[model samples]
Target: MGTRLRLTAVATAVSAVVLVAASVLVLALFQRQVTDNADDLATSRAEDLAALAAAGRLPDLLTDIGDDSVGQVIGPDGSVLAASASLGAAPAVTDRLGSEDPVRIDLDGVPDDDETEDYRAWLVTAQGPDGPVTAVVGTSREAIREDVLALGLALLVAMPLVLLAAAALLWFLLGRTLRPVEDAHLRQRTFVADAAHELQSPLASYRTQLEVAQRQDDPAGWRAVVSDLLAETDRMERLVRDLLFLARQDSSASAMSLVDLDDVVLEEVARVRPTTAVDVDVTGVSAAPVRGNRDDLARLVRNLLANAVRHASARVQVACRQDATGSLLVVEDDGPGVDPGLRDAVFERFRRGDPARGHAAGTGLGLSIVRAVADRHGGTVRVADGGGGARFEVRLPRV
Candidate 1:
């Protein structure tokens, strides 16, 4: 079943149980009140009959005894001396009756029919003019049963309507609550598809190069093909590492510590200098501290430096410092700066405003990684204007 239907079923079952419990409680309370009333009436009737008989006078005990009420005066020998007209010549319901406590009795075959009756009755023994006699009074339980059945029927009619309304309201609210998650899932699917398509380019190149190398008979041609193949493999490895780092940062946001921005910048610049001839200048450094994962922040700096080194005409400058707002890092190169309109677009995955930097220059994920790292650290990166070339500025909250 769908979520809505499943939730509705669960809610309906719970509401049904609650309704049933409430109905049973109400029924019990009503039954108790009716029983108490019946017992009091029966006991009062039995006491009045005993008092009249003991006074040696037969008053109006015969008055209004037809209200489903039965009373009888038993002689000292368990023989009936006086009784309501409805119970003519009937013996005591119980054989051993002495106290005036109320008792429940089931009257079956009272009128010689295939039916049974229920009653609450009280019995007492009192001194009479003739001798000790037993006084008994009782009333039928038909009225209590009728009220209880009526209540049950009313609940049976109303419960379904209440449950349906509640289910409908919950379905609407839950749909509204999960909409953002649904949108994110769709976006993730699209991202995966885009990533797969991007990855296919390098793999197809490797296959074509290898297939050609197998057919080429010249040793120099095979060697050249092998070198180009290794370059493509390096590109794929970098792409994989970038994807993994982004995924890890996405999954682990709380694993962050205080990071020194100046150290991160100087370290990346030094690493790049040993591998390339680009003149990387480091100038801005004055207590640029922030909170972030050390490895991820290092990766971010490396990407920025790599991007600069790949595209810089001659020199790349790395700057880091803390300001009143936050920590700032800027990587500027003297190559052709990006188009003003394409600055934001370059930070998207697989986006390369300077694809001329070649396959070996870097994966197009450099700026995207920079942006992702900044975002993970509760910071932001944007392409800001430089003096001559592109300047990528990063700002992160200070520790």
Candidate 2:
């Protein structure tokens, strides 16, 4: 069975057992209480009759003896003396009489008109004007049985409905709870497939280059082939490193501390200047302190700078400063700007910017990493108009 169905079944089964036990207990307690009430009534009636008989004031016909009950006064010779109107000249109710002051009995086939019924009877003896007499009082068990039966029927009908409701509620809640798990599973599968595809190209190129190099004997040709191999190796290493970093970010929380955002920006700009001809302008840089993992913040700055530098036609503007709400960092490049439509898509893993704007040189994960770091630090990153080029903005809460 499916997870939802299995869980629902288990939960419903437990509820069913509990409900059945509770219903049975309720019925038992209710039956006992009603039976006790009936017995008490019978005892009370019998005592009243005995008191009357001992005083020699007993009536020929017993009256006001309560509902669904009968009373009889029997002589020592087993002869009926006085009886409830319902008994109507019947013989003695029972021949089994004990010498005890009072006794209770569960009797079946007690005369009720032409038919017989069950009763709970209480018998007591008292001295009359002439001799000792027995007073018997009993309440029918039929009403008690009918009441218990009705309750049992009600529970029998309601239990399934309640169980069905509980099961349906569990099914709905479980589906909602597992939705995120299902989505994460889907994302993991997609990520693995994409990673494999990304790694395949460089591996194939590296193998083909190795095959070509094996056929060459000239040292110069071999040196050139070695350069190509080194470049491919560097490409693969960068891809692997990026992939591992992303995976780590997914599974772990980074250590955080107060970091200087402008310092990171300037350091990355300085690093890029020595490698690229693009003019790196940090004239707009200012102090912007924020709390985050220093290494991750540095990576975020590095990726933004790398993306701008890779695409910049001539100049890249870097700026960081403190604002009322938090720190604001902006990087703008004088290159083919990102299409407004592709701005959000650029931050997705393995997603690249417009090819008409610039060559896609990096592993296409730089922007993704930038956004990931920003999010981890409770910040937001977005693309905005940069006059003639693309502008990336990051906002982080102040420490």
Q: Pick the candidate with the highest TM-score.
A: 2
lDDT (Cα, tens digit) per residue for candidate 2, span 29-137: 9999999998888888888888787787778998878778888888767777788876656654565553456788766777777888887888988766667778888
Scored by CA lDDT, what does every candidate get?
0.76, 0.85
lDDT of 1 by residue, 148-170 (tens): 78877887788788777877877
Off by over 4 Å in 2: 1-5, 56-68, 75-77, 98-102, 109-116, 126-132, 161-165, 168-191, 212-222
Regions of model 1 farther than 4 Å from truth = 1-103, 106-143, 146-196, 253-255, 273-281, 308-317, 323-326, 332-347, 353-361, 382-393
Q: What is the TM-score of each predicted model, taking all chains together?
A: 0.64, 0.84
